[model samples]
Target: MNDLEDLPEKNKIFESDIFIKILTSPREAFKFINDYNYEKHLYILLFLAGMLRSFDRASTKNMGDNYSIWAIILISIIFGGLFGWITYYIYSALISWSGSWLNGKGNTESILRILAYALFPSILSLIILIPQIAIYGETMFKSENDFYSSGLVESVIYYGFFIIELILGIWSFVLCVIGISEVQKLSIGKSILNLLLPAILLIFFILILVLLFKLIN
Candidate 1:
């Protein structure tokens, strides 16, 4: 009989120690995921990614005059989690479907696992955001607040956090590309194409729709 330690990595999913691995050695992490079908934290990761995305949109677009900061945060977490869950599945499906055109091997489930793990850095950005919200309050999300004019020190801190968050976001994308490459069994170039093809096709479809609408009008 085989002992627990003698089992293959797939059978030892509970012992994988993937969270730290996903950040430090993403290629190996992705390889384990592809091999083991690791998906224990999928929902929470998707929810957090959604929340971060919602907060980003709120910062840029503002939440109108009626919402309080607490309300905004609450709404962002709940709705963003739902949106993230839905979009994660949609994106995985799109990537899988599109990648097949390049003779790629990954399916939607594998793509979903890759992306869920890839979101670790972006999720860490939430740690950076906590202090920004505490320091700036609603001004962080408001366009009329003249945020930078608060003080030189304040501006420096805000911008510093922003840069850190930006780096984490960029690193998240890097991880995604690396994870996709492993899952799809493709070169980095093809993995990038697999990732971008969905967006490119979506933009093209939208343009065609707009052209058709103009002609009809």
Candidate 2:
């Protein structure tokens, strides 16, 4: 009886994500996730945009005198829209498979609603990403026929990255599934973003760094 009294209150012992940690392994990844809910999604979209944009720019710069900043920026926007659409599809499929409940509300109807709403951000973001690409694609087209002539090679390379990005995205989406199983409060917005964040570095950082090293050599 005395020991029971000495212990902390059962309610007090369990902090927000603590129960989450107990229920889930690989705790570290999911811990920081609970914060910044919607912001995570924003980062995902931006990081994806940044990754696609940076790579295209790097390739153009490597094209020697044909490089045009205006052209690069414009193309980034178009690719960004495409990346965003892919992100949306993958996220919705994985999140639904995981039995996600949203807005701190746990219900079947809420889960379906969340899936239905994902299109808002995907379509809306394109309004800007597309225009930005249009501008750059125009400059690129005007400056060099190589950019167009090399279209086959470029498509092959882009599609390669797209496949890699999709694989990584699915892996992260599974992480989110593990995360949701325990936390239950897994923010749909954040999980969606986390799915694509790694590509920013994998596609851009690693590729650009290698080029920089070669240039110095």
Best by TM-score: 1
Cα lDDT listed for each candidate: 0.85, 0.42
Candidate 1's residue-wise lDDT over 1-217, tens digit each? 2344465766466346778788888898888778767677888898898898888888888773457899889888989877867888899999999999988899999899899889899899999888888887877777787755778987899789989988988999999999999988889999999999999999999999999999999
Model 1: lDDT of residue 98? 95
Off by over 4 Å in 2: 1-26, 31-152, 185-217
TM-score list, all predictions: 0.91, 0.28
Q: Report clashes for each candidate as comma-separated counts.
A: 0, 2
Residue lDDT tens for model 2, 1-217: 1232343565234334332432354344333333212122434444454444444444545532454655555455556544544554454344444433333322332232232222222223334445434534444324243444557867565455446545544544455444543344645565544334444435788889999999999
lDDT of 1: 0.85
Pairs with backbone N, CA or C atoms under 3 Å apart (clashes), candidate 2: 74-133, 74-136
Deviation (Å) of 87 in candidate 1:
0.8
lDDT of 2 at 69: 55
Q: How much is 183 displaced in model 2, in angstroms?
A: 1.0
In candidate 2, what residue range of length 10 has the lowest lDDT sum?
Answer: 112-121
